[model samples]
Target: MSARLTQRQRALQKFIEILVNLKGQMCGLGIPLVAAFENIGKENTGGVWSDIFMQCSSIMKERNINAGEAWKKALENNKNIYLDECDYEQLWDFGERLGKSDRLNQEKVLELEKEKLTIMEKKAREVAETRGKLYRSLGALTGAAVVILLI
Candidate 1:
């Protein structure tokens, strides 16, 4: 498993991935969201997100990087194209909140899956134990018969 990321980075990554998928779908129809995010990237306010967005793009360019990079690229490309800083912040913030909630929901699902696995494992163990006792009893009976024949 990959190491965990900070809440902000995680949120940013989620937003990026969502937008990328949406953009990809739109691209098939020639209506990509790139222009809208680019406008957001162009804005200089809303903390250091502009720099973060650029970095995200660079990171995404690498073969091993994940959704975070794509998000960065989306923001970078959006600058001077679609959104201002305030707009970018609003979108980014919204995405961040959504990401966190999504993550939490997924975690709950995984936990339930694990619980099911544990239940299955316990059932398997019970079956094996029962089989083991039956085998042991059969072995003892066979040994007793062999001794009687020898006598």
Candidate 2:
């Protein structure tokens, strides 16, 4: 509704666009930045989508802008024209967590694989023992038949 709100809206919109571009510009830079951006709206910016919305709302209550109409108009005509600094620390923290989780998962998988191999080896040994018993039984039966025939 008001010119100030309109300008702020454009600024915030441009900031979001810049953030999106910056996220893809680097391989390791994007994910943490995007996550931090999400937190910005929730944690820093009064849980609103942008500061422009909050500004326009305050203006509307005081008859500065036309009660949410300007907010809608700003959305239509907004352009992002700036790049803001990202929260590097949070990104690093998230990446660290991801790295640790990946390592733990790989270790667990290897442990399971080793256990599976051991079980397979034990099963093979059991099968070999059974086969040996069967062969001995057959040999003894054959010897008994020969002895009986001779007697």
Candidate 3:
């Protein structure tokens, strides 16, 4: 790794850090989704989560994470996961969905979580490698400049 980071690398590292924190907040605390969202602001470590929170619209503003007017707009803008796309509301129709058990719902949620993390990890690693190369080039340039100055 280089001694310094370019703007893009810094941004990617920050993103990965926040994503990992969000994952920990969900899995480590075992908090409900809504509860976790609400609690993100109070937690000092969830800056990325907090940024997403503000983007998602607060409950005070009558915005929902999944199915709502705000959600539709977010989807229109090509934003990430929303309830409208996931048909999360339909999951509540347990009568038709399954035989009176949340097992399927839990499995679906787990699968989604795993997918989310896997994608994030892949992106993070890619950015990290790219940034490492940029940093090496920059470090060599700086070293050459110093040698010329000293000579």
* Number of the top lDDT candidate: 3
List of clashing residue pairs for candidate 3 = 66-83
TM-score of 2: 0.24
Show where candidate 2 strays beyond 4 Å: 1-102, 139-151
lDDT of 3 by residue, 44-137 (tens): 7643335444433454246543423432343234333222323323223311322122444544544454455456446545755788788788
Q: What are the runs in model 1 whose C-alpha is more than 4 Å off?
A: 1-102
| Top TM-score prediction, candidate number | 3
Q: What would the per-residue lDDT of candidate 2 be over residues 1-151, giving only the tens digit for each residue?
A: 1233333334444444433432333223433323433333343433233554444344345554442354444333333412112222222222332212343453443344335434544544454466656767888898999999999
TM-score order, best first, reads: 3, 1, 2
**Which ten residues in a row are the worst by lDDT in model 2?**
81-90
Error of 1 at 53 (Å): 34
Total backbone clashes of candidate 3, pairs 3 or more residues apart or in separate chains: 1
Task: Give the poorly placed runs of model 3, Cα more than 4 Å off.
Answer: 1-34, 54-107, 142-151
Candidate 1 vs candidate 2: the lDDT winner is 1
Best of the two (2, 3) by TM-score: 3
Model 2, residue 126: distance off in Å is 1.9
TM-score of each: 0.28, 0.24, 0.43
